[model samples]
Target: MKKTKKLFGALTLTLLLGLIVGCGSSGEDKNSADSSNKGTTDIQKIKDAGVIKVGVKEDVPNFGYMNPDTNKNEGMEPDIARLIAKELTGSEDNVEFVGVTAKTRGPLLDNGELDMVIATFTITDERKETYNFTTPYYKDEVGFLVRKADKLTDTASLDGKTIGVVQSATTKEAIEKQAKELGVSFKYQELGSYPELKTALTSKRIDAFSVDKSILTGYVDDSTEILKDGFSPQEYGIATKKANTELNDKLNKSIEQWEKDGTLEKIYKKWNLD
Candidate 1:
C-alpha cells in the first residue's frame, strides 16, 4: 500500500511540473513572436523596397509640373520628394513620382499605391482623421483668376457669378464660407485640373478660376488677373497613410531640419517660388 501511494504521488507531481513548464514555454514563444514583429514597421518596409513612391501634382507649375522640354517632373514638390528619397534610400534617383490630383491622392494613399503625397495637400482637422500630415512646408491663400475684362476687384463683385474650383479641393468650402459672411452668393463649377479651370475661364464658361494664389500664378496670362482679394490661408503638408505614423514622423523631422538649415528655402528659390 505504501509503495502504491508513493508511486501515485510521484506521478501527479510529474504531471503538474510538466504542465507548468509547457505553459512557461508557450508564453515565451508568444513574447518572442511579438518581439520579432517589431522589425516589420512601415519605415523598415520602405527601406527594404529600395524605392519610395511619392504622389505629386504634374499640373501645378513651380509647385509640381511635368516639364515638356525635359520630360521630367521639375518643381518645388518634386525636389522635396527627391530629398526625401535620398534620406530613405541614400539616392534621390530612387524616387518614383506618381501624378496625383486632389481627387486621386487620397485613394492612392489608402490603397497602398503610394507611400506619401507631397502635392499641394491642404491640411484640415477633418482630413487628419484619415491620414497623417506633416508640418506645413508652404503657406498660401485662396484667390481668384478672372479675365481682366470682368472688372471684378473683390468678393463683393462675385455675387451670383460662377466660380471654378478644382474637384475635391477645399477652395469651394472656403469660398462658400466667405460668401455667407459677406452676404454674397456665387455659383460654382468644379473641374478636374487647373488647366481645365483656366480653359473654362478663357472660354467664358466660368467667371473666375479659384485656387491658391501661388497655383493661380502658373495659370495667369495677359488676359487674366489674380484678384487682390485673398482668403483662407492654406497650409500645405505632406500626407501619409494614417497607420504609417512612423513614416510621417520621419518626414516631419526631415522638414524641420530643412527649415532650420535653409534647405527648403533654397529649393523654393531654385524653383523661383520664394
Candidate 2:
C-alpha cells in the first residue's frame, strides 16, 4: 500500500514539473516573438533610441545649409527635420543632422545610414519606386542662374552654353528636357557638390548654374540673374525607405498638422520663401 502511495505521489510530482517547464517554454517563445516584432519597426526603434538621424543638404542655403557663424545647420529643410524629430521624440533636439549632397543622399538613405532625408528631395515616379516620400512640403521650379554679363534672357538663350549642375540630381534631365522642348542645345558639366557648381558659375567656368529656383536664389547676387521663366515644377518631400508605411503615415500626419496650424507657412516666411 505504501509503495502504491509513493508511486502515485511521484507521478503527480512529474506531471506538475512537466507543466511548469512547458509554461516556461511558451512564455520565452512569446517574449522572443515580441522582441523580434519590435525590432522590425523603425518607429519603435527610433522611440527606443530616442534619436533620429536625418540627411540634409549642407550647401543649399535657405533650404539646408551650414551657417558659418553658428557652425550648425540652419534653413527651411533643417527646421522641418527638427519638427519631425519633435513629433517623434517630443523634442526637436533629439535629431542628428548628417550633411548629404545630391550625389550621396540616396545611397546613404538606401544603406540605412540615415533614418530620413529632408534635403530638398524632389518626389518623382522613379524615386517613388525606391523610397517612400511624404506629401509635398514645398513646391519649386527649375531655373537658371547666369552671369548678368552674359545677358541671357531665357531658356532658349542657353543654347550652346555650358551649364553646371550637381550630379545625381534631376536638374540635368530637367534642363535637357526643357532645352529639347525649346529646340536648343547646351553642354552640361556635372559637379559633385552645389558649392562646386556655384563656384563654377562664379568663375565663368560654366555659363549658367541650373537647379531649383529656391536654391539658386541663395547664390544669386549682383553678378547673377535667374531666368524669369522656369520649368519642371517640383514638389519636395521627406523621404524614407520604401514601404515604411508606419513612418510614412506618421510623417504625413505631422505635415498635415503643421499645414493646418500655419506652421508650414511660418517656416516659409522665415526662409523668405513666402
* 36-150 per-residue lDDT for model 1 (tens digits): 9877898889889999999999999899999999999989999999999999999999999999999999999999999999999999999999999999999999999999998
Residue 225 local lDDT, model 1: 96
lDDT comparing candidate 1 with the true structure: 0.94
- The true-versus-predicted C-alpha distance at residue 44 of model 2, in Å, is 1.7
At residue 65, give the lDDT of candidate 1.
Answer: 97
Residue pairs clashing in model 2 are none
Per-prediction CA RMSD (Å):
4.1, 5.3
Q: Give all TM-scores, in the order shown.
A: 0.88, 0.87
Off by over 4 Å in 2: 1-31, 34-40
Query: Against the true structure, candidate 2 has what lDDT?
Result: 0.91
The digit string of per-residue lDDT tens for model 2 on 1-274 reads 9999999999999999999999999999999999989777879788888999999998988899999999999999999989888888889999999999887899999998899999989999999999999999999999998899888899898899998998899999998888889999999899998788889998899999999999999998888889997999999999999967899889999898999999999999999994
The positional error of residue 101 in candidate 1, measured at the CA in angstroms, is 0.7
